[model samples]
Target: MRDLPDPGPWDEPEQAPPWRPEHGEKPRYRYWPQGHRPALQALVDGRWRTLQVHSRIDYPDGRVAYQGEIELPVEGRPAEHHHRAYWWPQPGRLRVAYGTDIAPT
Candidate 1:
């Protein structure tokens, strides 16, 4: 309707609720059974490394919301980066939702 304001980003329907974590499941690796290629990469210092990925959830048409980690050498010490990634074919592509370096648990 002409009276309706144009929808900005938040108009999409919400995704289904994610499953509850198992007891003591502090670190979980949820994943799809199949995905082609290592769909994302990051350049660290002077080198590149393929990220290790797993999905917390996915839709039937290949839309996935995932989390993963990468091992990086920071100032000669070992570190891990926790990241969230998403795959959406429409206006969105495979990309990092957000990420941060985290201490090992």
Candidate 2:
């Protein structure tokens, strides 16, 4: 019978094999929530301004949440300022109010 091919270095028992064990693990954050609506209102010197408000929300762990930049215009300034805030559903309602100003920027 024909001689079979040698197993080579891989067949050596003294050498350790290059293999990694599998460990199925889950991620730390969960899926984001739905039906999240955010509204913004601007004011200057205790008076409400005409500028509109914009916001975004991200839920990481179901209970814990994160929010992004909120942009709004001041009374006199031509540019918009961006602010960030976070909220907890279990706690009471949180509102951010501002006063009016005469100067812009």
Candidate 3:
């Protein structure tokens, strides 16, 4: 069969840069409900093509930041948590690693 001449809506969008895991783990921020939380950052989002992997974000100081944080307040408490997650892109899907000795929930 011959290849199609002009592609239509099938055109793909700009792909996101691949994430580099630090010591075999990506640096991401996670959150918890508190009281029973992880030692480090809590879980938010770590899948491929996710908004959490934004390239550049505008900072309050008129500076572009490559990273940002997401958090939520705990119920009936005046505390909250932020977390970072690690991810790996695979064929047609993505892989996530919480951290050393830590598994994805």
TM-score per model over all chains:
0.32, 0.24, 0.19
Clashing pairs in 3: 28-84, 28-85, 29-83, 29-84, 30-42, 30-43, 30-83, 30-84, 31-42, 31-43
Candidate-wise lDDT, in order: 0.40, 0.30, 0.30
List candidate 1 segments past 4 Å from native. Answer: 1-30, 33-39, 56-66, 79-105
- Candidates 2 and 3 compared by TM-score, better number: 2
lDDT of 1 by residue, 1-105 (tens): 222222222223122233344322342435434442233444444354445554554544445444455554545557655343423332332344343343222
Between prediction 1 and prediction 2, which has the larger TM-score?
1
The alpha-carbon deviation from the true structure for residue 28 of candidate 3, after best TM-score superposition, in angstroms, is 14
Ranking, TM-score, top scorer first: 1, 2, 3
* Tens-digit lDDT string for candidate 3 (37-96): 323222223322322322233323333223223244445776343322222222333222
- Answer with 1 or 3, whichever has the higher lDDT: 1
Candidate 2 collision pairs: 43-99, 44-99, 44-100, 45-99, 45-100, 46-99, 46-100, 76-104, 77-104, 77-105
Identify the candidate with maximal lDDT: 1
Tell me the RMSD of model 2 versus the true structure. Answer: 24.5
Candidate 3, lDDT over the whole model: 0.30
Lowest-sum lDDT 10-residue window in model 3: 7-16
